[model samples]
Structure formats: structure tokens, C-alpha cells
Target: MAFLRPLGDTGLTISALGLGTVKIGRDQGVKYPDAFTIPDDQAVRELLALARELDINLIDTAPAYGRSEERLGQLLTGRQDWVIVSKVGEEFENGKSRFDFTPEHTIASVERSLRRLNTDYLDCVLIHSDGNDLEVLRQGTLEALAELKRKGLIRAIGVSTKTVEGGLETLRRADVAMVTYNLAHDQERPVIDYAAEHGKGILIKKAFASGHLQAGHADPVQASLDRILGTAGVGAVIAGTVNPKHLRENVEKARRAVGDL
Candidate 1:
């Protein structure tokens, strides 16, 4: 089982590795190395059950991730045991993507997510950036989420940022920041550094470079997990995999990585 850790000052204890649910919902607009059929209901159920058996408590999903939130709504059991992290802003429809960062959209998005996820409150919500991280912050996305947090619709607020500048600002405005960090890309290291010093949460996306780093190498998974979980500020690493074998491998590698520290 994966161990637990605090997500900065948010007062939420999350598992060291989070399950990303993109594969359970949408498959059209993703950048994964191999094409996949969306997992059936029974498959999703077994995979989620395996995740819990492996001691993963954090589940990362988004409205942009096809029907991920909706399926999780229908499938997940014992919501109180999971730290659900979802996103607002970007929406996927008709194989196209659109972005909205206004306070009105942010507020409405959270409400919609609550309904689709079948949860009265989400553990954390992030602003999904369309590569315009600074502009989204200027648009008061965090302020709107803060309002929801105050109203008890969500427990923690943050942004899945694309820029170091945006990440720094997000740490100032919110409780957590989800940034891309992997062996192949460390440009966002500063954001993790800042979060480390400031007591803010840092969640890593693409910890295996969306599985790109898993091939043509010896022990790529362990190498990347070592650098990521070994870092001080990293609260969790979110890796989405529907394959039970790969999920088990990820959990084991993550355990060794954190255990080494």
C-alpha cells in the first residue's frame, strides 16, 4: 500500500500516488503513446478496487476528461475514503477544446462537477489552464474557487498551471498547484522548490512523461519516481493508468522511491 502525506496547508492527507482517470472517460484528444479503448464499467470497477487495495486514496479527474467524473460518480464507493481532485476551465466537446476562466464559469463549473461526481464536496479543485496560466489567474479563477471553498462546496482550491510564474502566483492565492514534472522535463522545478519552502501543496502530473519515459530505457519508472517522490514538497504524483499491471508497477515504484527517502 502507498503511504499517506499532507497536501501542504490544505489539511488534507492524500496518498503518495494519485490515480488519473482520463482513460476511463475520453480517448480522442489525449497524448498517450498508445491508443486505448475506453475501459468498460466492469473493468473500471475492478481497476478502482485494485487502486484502493494498493492504498491509493487520491483520484484525479476533470470535466475535460470526457465522462471521467460522470463514470466515477456512478462507480466509486465510500467517497469518504478518497481524496478527489478535479478541475474547472477547459471543456472537451465534439473532439474540440475550449477555455473559460471567468469567476462565473469557475463557480458554475464546480457546481456542475459536484453533480456529475455525485459528491456534495470535492477535496480539491484546480483551474485547468489552456497554456495561458497568467491570463487565467488575472481572470479571478482562484477568487471564485475561494468563494466555493468558503461556502463548503470544496475543501481546497488551486490551479494546474503551465508556467512557473503562474505557479508562484497560485501558491500565493491558493492551497495547491498541480504542475508537470518528470525526468525528461524539470523546467517547473522552481515551482516545487517554492512550494517546498512555503508549505504549499505540489502535485505532479506526467510523472512518467505520459508513459513516454517508460520505454527504451532500463528502470525508467524507478528513476523518474525516485526524483519525483524523493523531492521534499511533492505531496502526490498523479499517473493515470487503467491497466491493473501498470498501476501495480507504478504503486510499487512509488513506494520504493519514497521509501528510499
Candidate 2:
């Protein structure tokens, strides 16, 4: 089994490495108009099974990544031990996407997410704050999250913020906060420091910088990972992997990164 890291002061423990499902559903290649396609269901199932076998218990997905939640629902039906963290804020219509954070939309999104994820409740519900402003973060959506928590729809609340400042604002209220801190985006250090100072549970995203850091060179990726592990209060590093071997390799790398700390 891989090492289980604590989620800040929260008692929940998760694998240091998580499985992200964007590539599984979206286009796989470098081009935009003709992105890569998802593999067959059997292939996806094999990858998911391999993840479980390797003890990766946190599976992070978003409805924004075309049909990923549905696929994950189908794949994770029997296994209830894993932590399923899904995001809300994007609405898909006629194959197009729109962003909405109104309270009504948020409630509806959670309902749809529950249905698509095939679960009674989510382990974590992040207010997918992409381009969402401070007032939205402070007023209506925050109330919605508290309501959802009150209603038992999610065990914990989180926000996936791109900027460290945005994450820090959310961190002031959320039980968990997911931030994009990797070699390519090392500017998030101050936010990481703030979260550490407050003892907020932190989940580091983009640790591999969307495959750039993993291109066989230690250059920036390894250094950034080392820095994050050395940081005061980072909880777990969430780097998605479809390949089982790569998943194991990531866990080993994380262990090494945290070893000297």
C-alpha cells in the first residue's frame, strides 16, 4: 500500500497520488479542434481496476470533462471506499459549455452530479471556481455550500481555484482547498504558505503540470515537488495517472520527495 497522508487536521487519510479523469474523457492529443479521444470502456475499466489494486483511493473528476463523471460512476459502482471528489459550475448543453454559479444552478448541478456519479452523496464537492469572482465566492455560493453540507449532500466542501489568492479566500471557509501548485506554476507558494499557517487541509493539483514536468527531466517538476513536500502544511499531491505503472511511479516519487523533509 502507498503512504496515506492526513488531510490537514481532518482525520481523513488519502493516497498521496490521485487519479484524474480528464484525459480519459477529453481528446488525448496536442491539437485543439481534434483532441484525443477516450479509450474503450474495457480499457478504461482496466486502468481503474489497476488504480484500485495499487491503492489509489482518491478519484477526482469533473462534469466539465465530457462524460467523465458518468464513466467514473460506471467504473466505481461496487467500490465505495474511494473518495470521489467532483466539481460543479459548468453546464453542458448541446455539446457546448456554459458557466453558472447561481444558487439554483448549484443545487441542480449537485443533483445532476449525484445522479451521474451514481452515489447518494459526494465525498467532496468543490465549487469549481473557474473565473468565478470574490463576491460569488463570498455570498451566494458560500451559502449554497453551507446548505449542501447541512443537507448531507457532501461530506466536505472544497474549491478548485487557479490563483493562490482565490484559494486562500476559499480556504477561509472550506474544509478543503485544491490548488494548482507545480513546477510550471511555482508562483502559488505564498498561498501554500498561508494555508500551511492556518492549518487548512491542502490538496496539491497540477503537480506534473499536465505532462510537461513528467517529460523525463528533473528540471522543474522534481524541484517543485520537493518544495511542496517541504512546505509547512500541504496535505496530499493529486497527480492523475491512467497508466498503472505510472501511478506506482508517482507514488514512489512522492515518497522520495517527502523522505528528506
Candidate 3:
């Protein structure tokens, strides 16, 4: 499979590197070290095209990512060619964020995501936890997602958790877990270890520490990804970059890091 890795037992394979679309949709409340303007539709179209050319198939978006879902729905083509992953529970509007984990909202959120993404189904839908990962899990979001999977709305369900306990619990009940992991943050390494042991999918978020770790290094991107991809259970690192050069650099570095090129 080269750089492609299995996404747990969900029967999906993702690349070692994946494109994050937040820069294409929202920039107001982001934490990137450098500020950026939201790319136009044409820019996003080209980005998606380049991603496909690089053999990157995973796309991560979320409701809290402002207009990301709507933009992807309008711009992304050949739906079957991508393994789309989106999130529910957090909503961003007018530069503010809100959370609702009720089962009713979960159902409505997935339905809304389907409409916004212009797809009948999503490969995975994660609970966009509000830092209270364990509490949010108990509020029926997982059960709701399970039902959605049964109904063919989402193939897999998981949580973008902020804590190790939540990560472990998510793997026990779901197919994937998105966690924060980077050179500066090894506190979550235990979560990745658990996923590795249990054959569960683990997607790495903040792989570059939200642009914090890239400064003051000769090649911090390579350094960060080498450490991340070298780990046993990581399925993919979702990095956001609207610049073509940066995107290509990330993919190339990630490919080299995987050592199967």
C-alpha cells in the first residue's frame, strides 16, 4: 500500500498525510502562528486537485470550521475518490462557537453535514468535544453515531478528544480517535500506544502544534512528521496549509518519512 495505512477496521485506507481544509473555510478564530486569508473557491479547487495528484485521499472538516463544509460541498468533485471525515457537536457561526451533544442534535448535525458536504454519506463523523471529552461521550453522542452508522449515514464514528481517558474510551466504543500529538506534546503518546495495541485507527491532529513547532528549526516539518509517522499506530497526520509549496513540501516530507517511497 506504500504510504497508505488502514483506518482501523473500518475497511478504509488513508494516506500518511492528509489535507486539512480549515484554511479554506475559516481563519477568524484559528490559532495558526501565521495569519491567512480564506482561499477563494478556485484556490480550493486547485488545492483539492493537487491533493489528488499527490495521492492524498483523506479530507478533515468540521462544523466549527466555519464555512468549510459548505465550501467542500461546492468544490470537491468525484466524491468516491476521497475518504471524507467531518465532526459534529461544535458549531461555529458569526465567529462564535457552541456545543450541543444531545442525541437529537447529533442526528440533526449529521444530516446537516450530509447536506453541506453534498454527499449522502460520510466515511467518518467524530464528536467535536468541547474539551470535556469524557462528559460529552456520556451524553449519548456515541450511541447516536452508532445508529447513524447502522442507518448508513456514517461508516465509522469516533471522537476528537483532548484527554487520554477520552481517547481510550473512544477506541473502546468507536472506530477512530483524533488526538493532539506533536514534538512538543508527548503527553498523548499513551493514547497512540493504546490504538496501536488494539488495532484502532488514530488520526493525528496538531501535528505541527498549530504552527508553533515549525519555527526555529532547519526543517521542523520533517522533524515533526518523522517523529509522528514513525510511531506504530498513526494512520494519518492532518496538516492544514493553503500554500501549494507548503502542501507539496509536507506531502513529500511525509512520504520520505514513511520510508517506503
Candidate 4:
């Protein structure tokens, strides 16, 4: 089985590998290595079922990921059994991306996410950093998220940081941190270490470098999981694959990675 780990002191446990929902919603303006057709509704339902059968409990989504949140709300059967992680600060509209981190936007975004996701509250909410991490943290965004948590609208709060300083600040101020750490780019390992030492949750993004490393390697998926999950602070790695076979493969790799640890 895929290992389940605690999301710091947030009182939530997440699978070591999460199913990312970006491809299920949006296919425009994406940086994927290759273009692919989006799957239909039945296909998505099967994928979610497969994820549950494989012991995957975390589903990563955001308002920026087109219609992902709504789709999850419609397709997911056992809402109480899974941990849903969404983001604020970024919104996708008409094939374009925009960011807002003000307190007003932060609170309003969480409320909208609740409505779209068909949930009373969110398991985790992150600041979708627009490469200005420090400024966002200082602009009462995290404070607003904290307020939501106080109101029982969110369980944990954090930022998807882009820089080392931002990751450090996230650790200082938030309950978790989403960072990019993989073989090609490991500049955020220090942030992982800090999270480990401090008992803060760490979620990995771009673990396979947006699928650019899929080709030209003997077993890139396993290699990537071994490296990232073997790290101390990582609570989960968000891997978005609509293919059921690939999803199982990733979960198998995650099991192996944790077993090796």
C-alpha cells in the first residue's frame, strides 16, 4: 500500500503520493512536455476509483485548474475519506492566469472554493504564489487564511513557494509548504529539511519535472519518487496523471519508495 503520513500538526494524514487534478480541468496554457486530449467524465470517475483502490487519499486541485474543483465535487463519492488540497492567489479565466493575495480576495476565494467543491470546508488551502512569495505573505494573505481556519473553514494553511526565502517564510508563518523538488531542480531541499525539523507539512510539485523527464530514462518515475519521498520532510508528492495504469505505477513506486525508507 502507499504510505500515509501526517500533515505536520494539522491532524490530517495524507498519502505519500497525491493525484493532481490539473489535467482533468484545464488543458490551455499548460507547460506540459507534450499535448494530450482531456479524458471524458466516465474516464475521470474510473481514475478516482482507481486512486481510492490504490490507497491514495490526497487530491490536489485549485481554482486555477479550470473546472477541477467542480468535477471533483461531482465525481468523488466518499467525500469524508479523502484529503483535498486547493489553492488561492491564482485564478484562471478565459485561458489566462491572474493572481491576487489581498485579504479580501483570500477570504472570498476560500468561500468560492467551498461552493465549487461542494464541501463545507477545505482540508488544506495554499497561497498560489505568483513568484512574489514574500510580498504575498506580508500582504495579510496568510492572516486571512488563518482567519478562515479559525472559522473552521480550513484545516491547514500554507503557500506554494517559488524561492528559498519564500519557502523559509512559509515555514515560519504557515502550517505547510508546497515546493518544487526533483532531480533536475533541488534548490528547495533546505526548505524540506526545515519542515522536517519543525514538523510542518511539505508537499512536492513538479516531481517529474512536468513529465519532461518521462522519456530518455530507464525508470524516471521510480527514480523521482525514490529521491523525493526518501527526503525527510515530504508529506506528499502531487503527481497529475489521468491514466489509470500510470496512476497505479506511480502509487506502486511510492510504496516502494516508502518501503525502502
User: 1-261 in candidate 2: lDDT tens per residue?
Assistant: 225677765456777667888767665322233334577788788887777776778888887777788887787745577888888886555656677888888888888889988899887878777655464586477678779979988877868887767777877877778887775676767767777787677888777666666444545656766767767778777775556677767666666776822
- The ten-residue window of minimal lDDT in model 1 covers 209-218
State the lDDT of candidate 3 residue by residue for 1-261, as single tens digits: 358889877899899998998888898888987879898889999999999999999999998988899999999999999999999999988898999999999999999999999999999999999999999999999999999999999998999999999999999999999999987898888889999999899999999999889466688888999899999989999999899999898999999899966
Off by over 4 Å in 2: 28-36, 92-96, 214-221
What tens-digit string does per-residue lDDT give for candidate 4 at 1-261?
A: 239989887899999999999999999999897887788999999999999998999999999999999898888889898999999999999999999999999999999999988999899999999998888888999999999999999999999999999999999988999999987899989999999999999999999999877555579888888889889888999999998888988988899999933
Let me know the TM-score candidate 3 reaches against the reference structure.
0.97
Clashes of each: 0, 2, 0, 0
| Residue 59 lDDT in candidate 1 | 99
Error of 1 at 151 (Å): 0.5
Error of 3 at 104 (Å): 0.5
Model 1 segments more than 4 A misplaced: 214-217
> How much is 251 displaced in model 2, in angstroms?
2.2
Question: Which wins on lDDT, candidate 2 or candidate 4?
Answer: 4
Candidate 4 has a TM-score of 0.97
